[model samples]
Target: MLLELRDISVNYGKISAIRNISIGVPEGQIVTIIGGNGAGKTTTLRAMSGMLPLQGGEIYFDGKRVDGMAPHKIVAHGIAHVPEGRRIFPDMTVEENLRTGAFLRKDKDKIEADLEDVFNRFPRLRERRRQRAQTMSGGEQQMLAIGRALMSDPRVLLMDEPSMGLAPVIVEEIAVIIEEINQRGLSVVLVEQNAVLALELANYAYVLETGNMALEGPASELHDNEHVRAAYLGL
Candidate 1:
């Protein structure tokens, strides 16, 4: 596995957010976690990105332990997180926001190349390169957020609710970009409330319920399961 969480648990003060949550991301594949609100999907992504400290359990990525590492150090280890909201800098220009993603890297030339690549992938960003991120539409901002995460040249991407608050067309656009990113050899752990889209894009899926693993299987299998269809797909 490129990324593995072994029996992990997280807490907020004394309350448990997730308990014994275990999931794995194989190299170069898309793995998704799907559930309704408060299912611990975002919490799991935060833990994987080292933004939240784990109370119990371990995280391994690329053969090294990363549970207790600082968030910046986790980025240095080639895991980039596009957080739940499109958290681009409001006052910063689109280019500047993208540059921030590469703050840990010293390779100026490669950074430039990656910047151009991001621009190429997201031409709306290129068109609005000098515009402040706060001025863009929600879908555009989501694109910028994903583009910024890519600037880090990560081995894996942890994405939380990428489809949130977007039109269906925009959601499909983001989904295409995700598949393109995965095809380029970046592993992804996706947390999404849109179970239909999640299952469509992911190779494997894990269903979360009230901070626990409820079910898991290959995406195709889960898509056809009665419980999943009724609960999440609204069939």
Candidate 2:
């Protein structure tokens, strides 16, 4: 497995956000977590990225325990998180924001090459390479945030609510980009409230409800589940 969460638990003061939740992602596959509000989907991704410390359980990445590592160290270990809210540097130019993602790397030539590759994958980013990210639309900002994460040349990408607050058309575009990224051999763990799209894109899926894992299976199996259809797909 590329990533594994074993009986992980997270706390917010005295309240538990997640408990005994276990999930695993193999290399070069798209895994998704789907649920409604307050489901702890984002919390799970944060825990794996070391942004939130696990009070119990363990997280292993490439066979190394990584539960309590610092966020920067996690990135150094080849994980990049495109956090919710598209938290790009608002005042920085697109190029500058992308450079920030590569702060730990000292190889300038490789960084430059990766930057060009990101621009190629996201031509709109190249066009706005000099523009401040704050001036861009929500969809564009999301793309920039994703591009910045890619600049780090990560092995596993953690994406939280990538389609949030976008028009349907923009959401579809993000989905296509995710598929394209996976095709290039990067592993992904996507957390979203959009169950339909999540299941459609992912090979494996986990369903969370109020901090507990409710179901786990292949995406195709879950999509055909009566309860999943009724609750998540509204079918």
Candidate 3:
């Protein structure tokens, strides 16, 4: 596995957000966690990114333990998180926000090349390069968020609720972008409420319920599962 969360648990203040949840993402494949609102989907991603301190358990990436590392240090370890709500800097220009993703790196020439690549992938961002991020549409901002994450040249990308609040058409667009990203050699851990879309995109899937592991299997098998169908797919 490129990324592994072994028997992980996390607490928010005194409240346990997730407990004993384990997940794995193999290199070059997408692994998705699907669950309902408040089911600890976001918390799992936060734990991997070191944004939340683990109450118990460990996280490993590229064969190194990283659970207690700082968030920026985790980013330096080649794990980039595109958090929920497309957390771009509202006051920063699109270019500035993209540069912030590369804050840990010193390769100036590669950074500029990566910036151009981001613009190429997100032409709309290129068009609004000088515009404040808050001035863009939600879909555009989401593209900016993904673009920003890509700027880090990460080996693994953790995406939380990438489709949340997006229109159907834009959701489709986001889905395609994710596939393209995975195809280009980045392992992905996706947390999404859209089970059908998530299952379709992932090679493997984990189901979470009330912050605990509920089910797991190859994505195709999970998609056909009667329980997953009834509970998550509404089939």
Candidate 4:
């Protein structure tokens, strides 16, 4: 497994947000965590990326225990998290926002090359490279956030609620972009409330309920599961 969560738990102040949840993601595959509102999907991803300390259990990346690593250290280990909200620096130019993603890197030439590649992948970003992020549309900001994460050149991408609050057409665009990114050899662990889209995009799926893992299987199997069909797909 490229990444493994061994009975990981996380707490926020006095509240336990996650409870003994274990998950695994193989190299170069799209894995998804699907859940309803407040089901702890984002909390799970946060713990994996080291944004939240594990209250119990462990997280392993490439076989190294990473439970207590600093958030920046976690990024150095090849995991990049595009958080639920497009948390771009609203006051900065598009190029500057992307630059922040590569803050740990000193290879100026390589960074420039990667920036160019990012621009090529999202031409709209190139067109507005000098524009402030706050002025951009929501979908454009979302694209900027993902493109920024790509600037770090992560082996595994953790995306939280990428489809939230977008129009159907924009959601479709994001889906296509996700497939393109996965095709280019990056592994992804996607957390989404849109179970229909999440199941369709992932190779494997895990369902979380009330801060605990409820079910897990290959995406196709989960899609056809009676409980999943009834709860998530409403079918």
lDDT string, candidate 2, 1-235, tens digits? 9999999999988999998999999999999999999999999999999999888999999999988899989999899999999999999999999999898899999999999998988898899999999999999999999998998889999999999999999999999999999999999999999999999999999999999999999999999999899999999
Model 1: colliding residue pairs: none
List of clashing residue pairs for candidate 3: none
Models, CA RMSD each = 0.7, 0.7, 0.8, 0.9
Candidate 3, superposed: residue stretches over 4 Å from native: none
Q: Model 4: per-residue lDDT, tens digit, 1-235? A: 9999999989899998989999999999999999899899999999998889889998999999988999999999899999989899999999999999999888999999999999988899999999999999989999999999998989999999999999999999999899999999999999999999999999999999999999999999999999999999989
Error of 1 at 74 (Å): 0.3
Worst 10-residue lDDT window for candidate 2 reads: 116-125
Q: What local lDDT score does residue 24 receive in model 4, on the 0 to 100 scale?
A: 97
lDDT of 3 at 95: 94
Could you say which candidate leads in lDDT?
3
Whole-model lDDT, candidate 2?
Answer: 0.94
TM-score of each: 0.99, 0.98, 0.98, 0.98
Backbone clashes, each candidate: 0, 0, 0, 0
Measured on C-alpha atoms, candidate 4 has an lDDT of 0.94
Global lDDT of each candidate: 0.95, 0.94, 0.96, 0.94
**Candidate scoring better on lDDT of 1 and 3:** 3
Instruction: Give residue 56's error in model 3 in angstroms.
Output: 1.0
